[model samples]
Target: MLGATLVSAFSLAGCGEEKAGAQLQGPPPAPVRAAVLERKDVPLRYEYVGQTEGSRSVEVRARVQGLLLKRTYREGAFVREGDVLFLIDPEKYRASSAQTGGELAALRAKLEQTRLEHNRISDLFAKGVVSAKERDDAFAAYDSAKANVAAAEAKMQSEQLDLGYTQVRAPISGITSQEVRSEGSLITTDSAGSLLTTITQLDPLYVNFAIPGTESMQVRRQAQEGKVVVPAEGYSVRLKLADGSVFEQAGRLTFEDRYVDPSTGSIRARAEISNVKAQVLPGEFVRVLLDGALMKDAIVIPERAVLFSQNGPMVYVIGEGDVAELRPVTLGQGVTGGLVVESGLEAGQRIVVDGIMKVRPGGAVSVIPEPEAGGEGKPVAAGKEQSAGNGGVN
Candidate 1:
């Protein structure tokens, strides 16, 4: 009986020591909140710096050379098409026109006299009353007289046109700039001297920008692979002014260059926006936001789950047996909810969002599923708190 009691005591002591040793050997699995990823089509947007310009920028110039007699329109004011902007000295042109008119009248009278003589001579030649040479001379004189009359008529028309050009008119309805030549200044019909003012139409403004070639290629490749869906109607554009306020009017992409610009290595593009109010001025810099692009079947995760290390951006994924596995992911654009996973993730995988610091590769974890709504999705034993708004570089 004594021997049996001693053996029993030793066995109990060994069992107790074994239990205590097991308790102190390692810690329990880390409690982390994880979420299962799902694939869905998500909208995408891109932004670029653009410049505002008038749809039509016209340099008003004088067509006729003369002294600038007067400027009819106010400087820096809106003017309508065909409105008289300037008056050049019309005295010389008027005198030239009058001279041409008088010469035309004399030529017409001479042509009539030659015609009557030619008819009488033709009748005489047919009746054998005149020689063939005489008849030919009469016909030649009549032809010469007609030619003179036509030449005089042409000169008269040109003179009248010059007289009309004395009054410089606005070619388009737009805002006009200051006069290049003041009244009494000589305005010549030459490249350097003809400029009277500049007119810029601001009703429909143009916004110009460029797209990088690399990004353009990537988008095309993704679209061909069924990874992206570009809208059929083209991208919808919005402008953000320099003051950080979004323009009330929206625009559309109107033009894109066929070839990439060699200097910039980007494709030139343009957008048209309604600027009836003239709120946006020309030559101003603005931010252009392009929308209506979609990412097809994309996997997104909360940005807080992403951890940056020397190796790159990585996340803690729950593997088989609820073990944490470190996964490297390629990031794309940021969306409203989180960052898009370009690669290195799949649907149905659980990623640790909250208590991310507590997760270790190859370590066991107790996954508490993230809630659908409300709460921080914190585990009972929280590690370090992380906000879901943290973003990775796109």
Candidate 2:
């Protein structure tokens, strides 16, 4: 009993000594830069460089041969359909029109005379005062006169059409380019007349860009494999202009090229965007955002907050009592906002964004108050570093 009492007393003394030593060696809490984490919907966007084009383009051409007497529409101005653009010399056309009218009038008079003779001959035949051959001749002359009148009327209609053609009108409503043929410029029904001016329809503009076919095929494979989802609304697009500004209007994916280019292995795609202000001009290069589908329920963290240890990629998660817990995380891709945390982090958790060097696993930490909007916590996407090459063509 005496020996057992001594043994218990020694154990108590040993525990006290170890506890004192631990207190002496314990380190102070490390100060860390941290961010409050949130779980929310993030857009999975695909960006590409693309150029713009007018939705519809037409070139005005002269259809008839004439001296370009006068131009009616202002050069490089908006023109409406059926608006007169040019006027060829109408004097020659008017003279031809008058000649056709005179020819028709003369033919009508001859037809009237022939009809009278035919009627008179028929009456003579009924009275037995003329031969049958004489009556037949009068009837044939009347038919020939009727045919002559028809021919003359056709010629008169042709002349009127030619006169109308002298006034060249706009085929469609659009912004016209500079006039190529000016007044007194002889316009012929040849190549010179055919290359008049170009008009561009600009209410809705087309943005044309090409994605490598292999990348597109890879996206399809992912969708089929159920790795990523494509929205029911299909794909939508937005643009970044040359000035690094987001365009006011959004666009829709309109077409995909059926054939891939052998040289570049890219398939062209077009997006139609409303250019109501003419802000997006044709043939201008713009940043194209193709995939805008939401990635439901994602965890995003800053790149600095993520670190690598022997355990692979890890983040220092701040827990209760401001204790730092090193957690291994799987990342999606580095995005403009931040790196996506696929696993090992939850919403409402705090993680160190900066000053991680002073932190250690299971150590107490002091978190600096995060700044307000546009603060240091804002994530900058490492665009090129993103996995799958900026999320691939999807």
Candidate 3:
């Protein structure tokens, strides 16, 4: 009986120790990072890749046929309207003009002689001093001389225009390209390959881009319904270059195509921006950002907090006791660094911003201050914070 009691007491003590050990080994605290929910303004913007094009572009070509004698303007140099760009061999044209002028002068003298003879013949015919045939022959000669004079005058005018054409002048004020035909190269008026140079006006530039048909349709429908407010005077637009630098000057949306591209199923739009400094060039690829629409009370969350699941998009929300609760969400347009949640979740909910992978549903989470990015946490401005906060959940 004494041995039995001692064994039973020892077993009870072992059980108590095991139970204490098990109780001490509680569930580990969830490693998590979080972000505060604040209300702030979030400007809705759409990003699209576009290309820059000059507002005006023209190709310069030789108008008259001649030997290219001189290039007056330097290649790739800015030129003014009426600036001489090329000097074709004017000698041939000059000779032709001179010959025509001389002939015209000679014809003028002959015309004077014909007039005098006609006057004399009219007097003789009136006085009946000469035979009818003689008078008629004199009149015919005078008429022929008058016709010759008219022909010569017309020829002179034609030759003068041809001579003027030898000096190729710029039709518009813009930059000039390299000489396609070098000096002494023969060029013709009707040559199939007569491209001389190209000029593009680059002060104010145009940005051409396409928006997906669905997005465009939404914009159009909203605009028609008067539910969305587009800028009345000038809609603001921002540009992103191929190198990812944002352009300094803001642009305006000037045009939208009436038809959608059949192949791409996108609608084209154009924005005009002042590039007086020649910052934007033709054929440069860029991105255009249009900003105007405002959501009064929209909910937004940091993009990192949103997770893609087979079920749909979801985010982990910290509930009553810092417990993670996975909530499926519907997302709207994405803004910079975050997404606009159309549904699910609510305002004032703590979201795991960092260390998301370490937490699971119903898991305990410790709310710690997010480490300052870089050296210091960027101070959220008063109104801006509210705007940003509203972007997550109302």
lDDT of each: 0.88, 0.80, 0.79
Choose the strongest candidate by TM-score. Answer: 1
**RMSD to native, candidate 1:** 7.4
Clashing pairs in 2: 335-381, 336-381
> Least lDDT summed over 10 consecutive residues: which range in candidate 2?
384-393
What stretches of model 3 exceed 4 Å from their correct place? 1-25, 31-41, 99-158, 191-193, 221-228, 368-394
Give the better candidate number (2 or 3) by lDDT: 2
Q: Please report the TM-score between candidate 2 and the true structure.
A: 0.71
Collision count for each candidate, in order: 0, 2, 16
What is candidate 2's lDDT per residue for 1-394, written digit by digit as tens? Answer: 9999999999999999999999997887776666677766666777888998988898778776778888887887878889888888878888999998998999999999999999999999999999999999999999999999999999999889888888888877778888887789887888856566788877698999998898778667766865456777768889999999999898899898888999989998999999877787788999998765655566788787778778789998889999988999998755557887878888777777766787788998765443436644333232111111111111
Q: Tell me model 2's lDDT, rounded to 2 decimals.
A: 0.80
Task: Give the per-residue lDDT of model 3 (tens digit) for 52-143.
Answer: 98888888888888788888888888888899888888898799889888988988898899889888988988898988887888889889
Model 1 agreement with the true structure over 1-394: per-residue lDDT tens digits: 9999999999999999999999886676777766777888899888899999999999999999999999999997888899999999999999999999999999999999999999999999999999999999999999999999999999999999999999999999888888888999999988999999999999799999999998899999999999999999999999999999999999999998889889999999999999988899899999999999999988888888899899989999888998889999999888767899989999878778877777678888776533336845643322222233323212
Model 3: worst 10 consecutive residues (lDDT sum): 382-391
Q: Best by lDDT, which number?
A: 1
**Candidate 2: where are CA atoms >4 Å away?**
1-28, 32-41, 111-143, 303-337, 341-350, 354-364, 367-394
lDDT of 3 at 46: 83
Q: Which pairs clash (backbone N, Cα, C closer than 3 Å) in model 1?
A: none
